[model samples]
Each structure stands twice: as C-alpha cells, then as structure tokens.
Target: MDQQTIINSLPLHLRPFVKQQRYDDYTPRDQAVWRFVMKHLSRQLADSAHPIYKEGLERTGIALDHIPSIDEMNACLARLGWRAVVVDGFIPPAIFMEFQALKVLVIAVDMRSVDQIFYTPAPDILHESAGHAPFIVDIDYAEFLQRFGEIGMKAIASHADLEQYEAIRELSILKGCPQSSRQEIETAEEKLAKLCNTEQAPSEAALLTRLHWWTVEYGLVGDCEDYRIFGAGLLSSLGESQHCMDDTAVRKLPLTVDAVMSPYDITREQPQLFVTKSCKHLSQVLEEFAASMCFYRGGTESLRTAIAAQSVCSACYDSGVQVSGVFTEVLCDAVGNATYLRTTGPTQLAYRDREMLGHGVAHHADGFGSPIGHLKDFSRCLSEYTIDELKAHAIEIGQPTKLEYLSGITVEGTLQEVFRQDHRNLILSFSDCGVTDLHGRVLFAPEWGTYDLAVGSAICSVYGGVADKESLQLFKPTPRTSTLRVDVDPSLMACYSLVDRLRQQPAGLDADDGSIEDALLAALAQYPNEWLLRVEMLAVADSNLQQRLLEELRQLGTANKATEQLVAMALGDFPAPHEDRPASA
Candidate 1:
C-alpha cells in the first residue's frame, strides 16, 4: 500500500486531527492527564511498538503539553472534510455508524486520574480521542473506518442483532471498560471480577474482547529489520509504549485475521504481538473484508463456490527419519477457499520430491555388505517392531536391541555383560537394527563381536577394548535392498534450494546483509533439475515485482506451506502493547 499517496490524499479537514493542535485544546487537568498518559505510554511504546506509530505522533503534531479540544480537532478535521464530536458517554451503535456515514469522528471525552487507571467503564477522552483520532487522518485508515461503519450500518439495517455488531465493534474498540464516573468505574470493575471468578462469561466475547485489547489497543509493528507503532491505544499511553518495544517476554507473530481475533489478557504486559507489514496493508485487509461481507451476506463460502478450486498439497515424510530442527509451514486460504499444511515435527521432512529425494534416512556402511544401500533404496519406510515381536525377540535373544542400536532411539534399560565375540578379520554386518555409520548411512549389524558388543553392552562399557583378535571379526549376509523413490513437488524443491543457498551466503550481501529475493533464488537453484519449471513459473508470476513475492508464488500455484513461511521470514513479528484493565479487587 502507498502510504505517501494516502497522506497526500487526506482531506484538509482531517489533516488537523493528525496535528498537535487537537491536543492543545485540553484543559490544564486534561493536559496533566495527557502528560501522565503520554509519559507512561511513551515508555511502553519505546519497548514494544512500531516506529511508524511514533512517526504518526510526530505527524499528528501531538505534544506532551496539552489535552486536544474536540472543537479544535474538528476544525483541523474540517479541512479534510472530517470532524470530531464530543459524545456524552458511550454512544449507541446506530449513532456511531451514523457519525461515520457523515464522515464525523466521534470520541467520548472522558479522563482518568493516575489512581483510577486500573478501572474505567465510560469512553474517556483519553480512550477515544487519544486512542483513535490520529489514525483518522490516515487516508487509507480513514477509508477503512468509513467502510467499517458502512458495513456496520448495513448489518444493523438488515436487523442483524445489535449485540453482535456491538460485540464485533467492541473487538475493534473499547480496549477495556470505560467508566463515566469514578464510582461507576469501581462498580464495573467489581462486576467484571465477579464475572471472571464465576467463569460464566461467554468465551467468544471474552476472546474477542481480549483480541481487541491486544491488537487494536496495544499492537506493535515491525520485525527484526524494522518496527513502528500505530495502534491508538498505544499512541495514547506513556509507559506501555516503552515496554512494548524493548521487553523480551513478548512473542510476536505475523498479522493474520485469525491471529488478531485470538484472545489475550490485558491486565499485564503482553507476552505476544501480531504484526502487519504496514497500516496500509491492514487498511486494505479491512476494506477487502467489508467488500467480502457485502457480496456474501451469509459468509465466505459463497465466494469460494464461485471460484475455481485449487488442488491441495500434502507433505509426506519417512517414519524413522527425525527432522529435529526448525522448518517452515505455509498455508493459503483465500476469502472463500481455505487449506493448511504444516512442516513441523520430529522425524518428518517436507520437500518437493522432484527437486530432492523423498524424505528418508541417509545411510553409511562398510563395503558391499553395508546397509547404506538399504537406506538410500527405501522410500517412505517405517521401522516398526510390534510389542509382541519385541517380546518374542527378547525371549529368543535374551534381550531386545539396546537404545544405542536404534536410530532416533529412546529407551530405558541397562546391559550387564557381553556374551558373544568374533575377532579374526574386518567384519561387515547388516540388521534391521536402525544404526547409522559415520557416512550418514543406516546400517544393521547382526553378529555381536567384542568390539560391537562392548559398544552395545552399556554406556559405561562402550570404551572397553577388544578382548582378542577373533572378537573383532563378525559378518552377516547381504540383504536384498529395495530402492525407494519419491517424486518431488517441483515448486517446493526450488524454494528449499533457494533458501538454503541464501542462508549459506555472507550476512553482509544486502544492506541488512539479507536479501529475500537473493535467498529465494539461491534456494531454487540448489535443486536445479527438480525446480526449474517451478522457478520459471514463479519468476513469470512475479515478473513485475509489484506484489509480495509470497503472494505471487501462491498465484503461481506454489504450496501454501512454503510461501507462508517465506513471507514470515521477510517480515518479523513484534509484541503488542498491553491495555490498562481494571483491578479485580
């Protein structure tokens, strides 16, 4: 989204709302409150917020000295054909929408003392004007809000329950309870505590409320590369502002509608944040949502039905091959169609078969008798031993295979003594034992020579020397190997190859020493034969580089799992700020 264009297009009236003058209208007390709030919130913002939000404050011309007057704000907004109105208190949903249709921004003018920060039931001037007004000047943001208002009005006109509309809107506004008076704040907080204690509150409402508190109220922006703050709630608070940007406890994830809607607790500093690439992207998302609802009154399914369906891709892995490292998952679900795939777990691998061999264990062995061939040959094989079979084997051999003999082994026991010995010449062996030699080969050794026996006997005995020459020469028959082959999904192969290459490059290549495009190309090249066509398709889809590379990949039919991950890597997540909630007592 073009932020500069949005800024350029903001109506003259609304421009003032973004300026510091609106805050100047504040009374001495209001100014004191603003200063106090700013001081605290600013501190919090510095810790967890996006840099854009701070920029927004600078753009809005808000200063630490005063409370902005509604009239003065309205005057500034008037230039952009926007106006701010003082509300008696919480306005009805109908009025809220009506104000939006008319392009008049309504903010409840209330204030809280430092002592009263924990509880409030009425929309105070701090919560509304400070929490919401600046974004009103952002053209795309203003459009988003207007569209939201329109959709909300339509829903109301259609006789959709006012409660549901209120609930959803509350999810976007009212970070927590807003009080009309000190007494009211105290009473409302008591009620909330009772409700929480009783556990009778609707879980969905609680979830939505928490989501609003976190994202709309205190959400942060940026990743490791860069970040800024934009949420109104954060913009208005002093301490929260600093805490959000610097704290280590916070967990940040890329923004998604589901993630935004997810529940959170607002009483303390947030442990996580949902980040978007930019406010413009968020505005576009909201716009798309509004449009979607207009077209599909019942919901998203109708849209899905209208579009051609894409085939779903599934990742397959070998059973015994443990992937004990981090990997990425990408899922694509347009408004109407939804599908998900994950590439996470132990003993699992996901890759396009065409670009690389199917998921399997690598093997190493000694000469022709080595089981390395078996590992390389078998595709998608599971090493299984039924409890009964294991028991039988234990009875016959006096013990089942020790944990040391197993690949990806987990077991509990102790080996007392070495029973067998064969030392004469270098010996080769094979077993279904699931052990790997030094060459990344999966091998099975059958005969227990002194050398092998000592290693397998127990952890303590592993270093014992061979007793005799005859104890070292053990042999086993060469087992027939069945080669396993898996077809790689060309697109995935290319992506993985590209990522791997980029990871190997010197970190100083790009300005940040990181080049997403370069990394992508390298990952693709790593599996040249398998992903050539896929790479070509991706390049063609993204030929203009106008859309996000991941989005373009989706358009080119790349697996959602891979694309989602690549996008996440490009954009990092930051923790949102915490909303001030009423104390339970």
Candidate 2:
C-alpha cells in the first residue's frame, strides 16, 4: 500500500495508536495482566512519562479503570484499517517485521507482576500497549515503523548474519552506547553475521532502526520554545518524560542522523534530547535515509567546530596568561617612542632584531640601537598616542615586536613552576606596558598593538559573557591571607600550560616581558582597585626571590611604554625626549 494512502485511511482517533499497538488476543489473564501492568506503570507515567502517553491513554480508548482486552484494541485498529496479533513471547525478527509491514501491531502474551517491574525480558502486553501504543497513532510515526519493519524483515531474510546487526542496533537505540564502543560491537557483530549471510547484513538496517528511534521514537518537539514530547519511549516512560522536560542539564539539541546513532545512556533519563521541528521533518529525514544521502559514519562540520571551540575556550583564562602589579613611570632621555607594529601579511611574520631595525628606520634615528630606550620614552608619552598611530606602527614593525616585549620574562620553565606552587603569593606586576585604557575603548600598544579591549570589557562585564565573568571572579586580585591560596581553575591552568609549551616550541612565540605586563594591565582592568594592590604585593615577592623576575617585569612595562610613546610621538603628543638631546651628549 502507498504510504500516504495508508496514512489517509487511518482512523482519526486511532491514528496515534497505529505506531504503538501490537495485535494479540487477550485471555482472561491477559486482560487482568494489562490492568495490573497499567495500574502500576500508570503511576510512573502520570508523574514523568511523556504527555503523549497520557494522550494515548485517552485517544486509544484504553481505560485506566480496567484492563483493556485485545479484542477492543483490534476493533479500534480495524477502524483504522490496522489490526493486532498475539505472540507467545519473543517472535523472530522476520515475523515481527511481517506483522508491522501488514499494518498490524504485535503484542507478546506475557505478564510481569508488580514485583518484577525492575526486570522483564520480552514485551509483555503492558510494555507493548502502554509503553509504545500512543505514538503508533501518529501517521508519520506509524509509516516510519512500517517501513522500518519491512526493511528489517528484508535484511533478516536476505542474510542470517544480520541478526547480530538487528540485536546490536536494537540494544543501542533502546540503550545508549558510546560511539567508539558501539562501532566496535557493531563491527564484530557484522563480521560474525557476515560469516552466515553476506547478501543482507543487518548492520545497515540496524543503523536505520537506531535513526528511527532517535527521530521517531524518542524525539522532542519545538526549539527554544515549548517542547512537546513525541517519541514512544519518552511517551511511555512516566519518569523520563517529566525529567527530560524539567532538567536544566537536559539540553534539546537539533536532531541529526549522527546524533541519533551517537552514544547515549538509556537506563537513565537522557541528559540531552534530540529535537525536531515537526513530525514532517522526521519523515523527511527517513526519506533522505531511504534515498541514501545520510551515511552511518562521518559527522557534520558544525559538530566538529562546536567540539573544537568548546575545547579550547573551556580552558581557564588563568592558564593563558598571568598578570601582576601595574607601575607607572616616566622616562628621562629616551630617543623615540616604541612603534606599534601589527602583522598584516597572510602568514605570521617573524620579529627579530634585524626586522625591528628595518621597521624602526623611519621612526627612530639611526635605526634601532636599543629597543629598550625607545620603549621607555614611549611609556612616558602614553597620553599622546592615538589609535591610528598605534596601528600604523604595528603594520610596519610586525607582530613579533609584541613578543619582544615579553622576552626575558621567565614565564616558561622554573618560573612557571614557582608561580604554580604559590600562585597566591606571587605577584605578576605590570609596568606601563604600551597599553592604554583609552577610556576602556582599546588596549593600544606599539609594535604589534591595538586590540579591541572594549570588547574585552564587555565580555568581562560582570553581567555578561560566561568567560569574562568567570575569569574576573576567579583571578580577581585580593589581599593575601594565611587561608588565601590562589589556585587557578583547572581549565585556565591548562591554558597557561599550553602557552608555556608553545613558547618552548622552536617558533619562539613566548610573550615578551613587555607584552606580559601589557596583558596583565588588560586583565587588571576588569577588577577593582584592591586587586591591583594584591598584584603589587605578589610582584614584590617574585622580585625579592628572582632578579630576572623584576627585570623581565620592567622590560614588559618598558616595552608597553615605548609602544605608547611611539604612537604619541607619531600623533604629535609630545617631542621625542631623546630627539632634542645632543647627539654627542
């Protein structure tokens, strides 16, 4: 029969049951058993089962007041051109498929006492009717089931080896398995089944079954709005239905074929629900599967992007960079402000002394004899640099100079180890690293500079961005107390470790002392004044223990200062301090 025609012929009231009903004659015990099963499972469904299950109860004319007889259900099915059949217990896959292909629901004649609720192997009347019936009424759902059954039977008949495929797919959909593990099990089963019959491997059909379950059986409705329950498992399970809708952690992601086959835990309520816009959408998915556009392996790009972004971003900010105290100092006789340089090339440009000299020629007299001299003067003229001036400098000098500022800081190796041990006590001090607050607009630096720090502020706004708020709260500087042990969150700490590891790599990407100082200043902007004081104290501790620590901090601060000075000089903020000094003097 044509799919839509079958759908059209279905009785309006019984349409919902078409997907759920199994045909079987009820003996006296069967009726009693149905009543007994319904009575107990009803309690579970009432509180947590999908709303559809309750609707099924009302729509299918199955009364909660008494056990429903098979004859009565068959009459309802017959009205919809469907029927119910009875099986002793477990039926062969082919027979089950045949029943479904004929638009007949198969109900197994078995009973589970109230005590045995926890364990029942085969589908008893309670499970067959109550657990799965309501969804059968939905035309799309019923069609999918019929198709699934037909496909399943064909595969079974074609190949004996496919039984394991059927079993594993059933187990996976009914139960969730991790993807790798599921694949392994499916592979083994397929190989074993193949030994028997290669013509029809159950693996392919089994995958479709899983897809059907994910989309048609346990699928959810709606997007960010109200989600209606539709899947038969959810429709049947009282507790799961309630839990899925109410749980905050139970995210409803857009459904895709991969997500259905993806591992999940069925014993527990799903932590995530696969949501479809409508039943038609699900039907379309099956149609695609029938056409063979959807494959069993390979995932979508969006999924990969989500995984990568989440993995990298999840690491704590503390792990990426450390900040200390801020120091504002004036330079005496520096020749020129340090120029801000940005890398505009497609590939990353390496910044070395020679490169700095080449870029510094137009701005600094006699090229760059000492980058430090330029850096100090740059810090003194911080007020003069404009955004444009900084950008121009960065474009010419390249991004490497930014790394130069961080050079000599022991951010790698032993220093990192020391900081790790006593992160609370160690202060990451900042000097006038060429970064300017710009009224919270941008974090401007000369020689690889000018970033959208305003966006940083917005992200770090206590009221917004998760990353910003979390970083600020965790790293906010505070006075050291005996009980105060500053420990970076594990994720952030990992970032810091990554940075350190990257620095050690041959490329030499370590943040120079100046860049480090600038980064600290940027970080500190998110916190209160007290946090600055705490940072200063920590810096002092490091200064006392390691001479390199202070020098590096000074360099970082100086580099920042130079970048700003260069920008200021370029923008005509003030005369370059050393330009006026006698060349001989």
Residues 333-411, candidate 2, lDDT per residue (tens digit)?
1332222211111111011101111122132222111111122224422113444554444411223223122111111
Error of 2 at 566 (Å): 77
What is the TM-score (0 to 1) of candidate 1? 0.38
RMSD of each: 31.1, 39.9
lDDT of 1 by residue, 42-74 (tens): 555564454444554544445543566655555
lDDT of 2 at 38: 57
Instruction: Give each model's whole-structure lDDT.
Output: 0.39, 0.39
